[model samples]
Target: MTILQVGALPVRKSRGGFEILLISSRETGRWVIPKGWPSKRLSDPDAAAREAKQEAGVTGKISRVPVGSYRYRKKTVEHIRVLTVTCYVLWVKKERKRWREQDQRTRVWFSQEDAVKKVREPGLKILIASLEVRPKS
Candidate 1:
């Protein structure tokens, strides 16, 4: 069966306008949005919000509905599984001094254009690119 994941494209209003938060993958250290496997107890949007807090040290208002989806191959010990991630927009309200994965990952905030360039996944890149034109309110 295909694996399902939830993710948050965390955005916050900045002096310039808006910025997106990107975190490095623990294994590859590539730029990515905060994401993880779906939680059995939490709704998708809430799960995405939990991931954002754990992975990026930010808290915010999460959209009730996903803004988009992306597919990627994830390699496990024995096999590679296709992961379909549903992405929600998180309008950041607070940033913490530390987070759960702070030591295991690096998090940075970038402009939408730069974030699109930094992320490796093609589908995710397209999603970030779309934000330039249709920014979250």
Candidate 2:
């Protein structure tokens, strides 16, 4: 297993509730949360935040219960099983138009419920369903 991470769950505020940010991968065009490998210098939340900025063009604070793990098949050299990805909820503050200009990225915001259904893997859906949306205190 390569243990490739699926990325972080960046979200935007919606009329009904918080919405999760999603991006289609450059390679597969598959919808996924913004994520990348853990950076040596950045903390997990910071790393996730960076990914959201780079991939989804959104900046926000990500905080929530440590969402559960999820597994998926990745095409990193070949079809490899990704062991797990730690998911988190991010509060989006800004959207950078420059990042969305990338031909590789197709960013969109969905209601958390919609996003939970949009993901391909069952574990990911479970992980999302497990997410505890913090009350805006």
Candidate 3:
């Protein structure tokens, strides 16, 4: 069975433009959005929001609907599994000084262009690119 995950693309509007929050992957040390397995009680978007809080120490307004979905291979103890992650856009409202995974990961804010270059997943890059064209609400 395919594993499902939810991710949050945390963004904030700035004078220069939009900025996105990225966290370093625990194993790979590569920049990525806050993501995790689906929660038993929370909706997908809510799960994504929870992940952002735990992983990136971010509090934000999350979109109810997913912006996109991406498939990737995740390594397990025995083998690899294809995982599908639903991505949600979160407009950051507050950032805490500490979080659950803060010691395990580094969180940084980057410009959309810089963030696109930092993320390794092609599908995620495309999602970030699309954000540039989306009309501000």
Please list the C-alpha lDDT of all candidates, in the order they appear: 0.90, 0.73, 0.89
> After superposition, which runs of candidate 1 have C-alpha atoms over 4 Å from their true positions?
132-137
State how far residue 136 of model 2 sits from its true place (Å): 3.3
lDDT of 1 by residue, 1-137 (tens): 97889999999877667899999999999999999978889999999999999999999899998889999888899989889999999998899998998999998999988999999999999998886423446
The TM-score of candidate 3 is: 0.92
Residue 41's lDDT in candidate 1: 97
Query: Could you tell me the TM-score of candidate 1?
Result: 0.92
Model 2, span 60-96: residue lDDT tens: 7776444666777666666565566777777777888
Any residue pairs clashing in model 1, and if so which? Answer: none
Better of 1 and 3 by lDDT: 1
Per the 3 Å backbone cut-off, how many clashing residue pairs does candidate 3 have?
Answer: 0
Cα-based lDDT at residue 48, candidate 1: 98
Q: Which ten residues in a row have the lowest lDDT in candidate 2?
A: 1-10
